[model samples]
Target: MNFKSILFALTTLVTLSLAIVLNPQITSPSADTKWRAGDTRTVTWDTENVTGGPIPEGMKGTIKLGYLDPKDGPNEHLNWDLGSGFDLNKGSFVVTLPSELETKRTYIIVLMGDSGNASPQFTITAAR
Candidate 1:
């Protein structure tokens, strides 16, 4: 193969490897998940995908509640901090949904850290 072709192949492999190592895959709150306002739910991810094995001590991450209204076009709004300063290595955390949240099917959970990873869109219904 030509030198340029070899170089391009190597670069592409490195980039894909880095992406796999750096991005943690969210596993919970799946596409079929339905959470109720005022309820506590567990958010989980694949710890194996985390770089350097587990997250280091004192390394923290935040979880945010995101909203995308179909009526409002494609703008996604991260409107609330569900929790923060969490250990990303544990692979999971429990969060209490705010009782005041409106019933919506477009709610998503975003895990914020070195690289933000989001869960599939889920439903959040009004509290009973």
Candidate 2:
């Protein structure tokens, strides 16, 4: 191959490698997952290729269990905060579903704070 071609390939490789190494990754709660009301499930996450860094000077992270509209942002009607002030490095935590649900509706789980991530669209069936 020509020298220019080789150099271009090398630069591309380095750029991709740095992108993966510098960005954080969320590793759990497969997309479009379903969970019933009054159920307990574990939510997991990870930071790929990341090591020690500066600790946050404020709140760590919060777990938000609620609803979202495709047009607007958050749906306050179905909003419920699962947790708050949790350590970003906690990795995983158990979440208990509400025992009662008013109606069969779609919901979502979000991890926001020092890090931001979300679960696939999930539904909460009315408790039997």
Worst 10 residues of 2 by lDDT: 50-59
How far off is residue 86 in model 2, in Å? 2.1
- The deviation in Å at residue 67 for candidate 1 is 1.2
Q: For candidate 2, what is the total of clashing residue pairs?
A: 0
Provide C-alpha RMSD values for all models, in order.
Answer: 5.5, 8.5
- Residue 83's lDDT within candidate 2 is 69
Model 1: residues with Cα > 4 Å off, grouped in runs: 1-21, 50-57
lDDT of each: 0.84, 0.62
| Per-residue accuracy of model 2 over 1-128 as CA lDDT, tens digit each | 99999999999999875544222244555555666778787777664443333333443667767666677755534366676766666666677878775444456667775445566666677667
| Candidate 1: pairs in clash | none
User: What is the alpha-carbon lDDT of model 1 when measured against the actual structure?
Assistant: 0.84
Residue 15 of model 2, lDDT score: 89
Per-residue C-alpha lDDT of model 1 across residues 10-83, encoded as one tens digit per residue: 99999976555345778989989999999999999888856544555665779999888888886669988989
List clash counts for every candidate, in order: 0, 0
Q: Mark the 10 consecutive residues where model 1 has the least summed lDDT.
A: 49-58
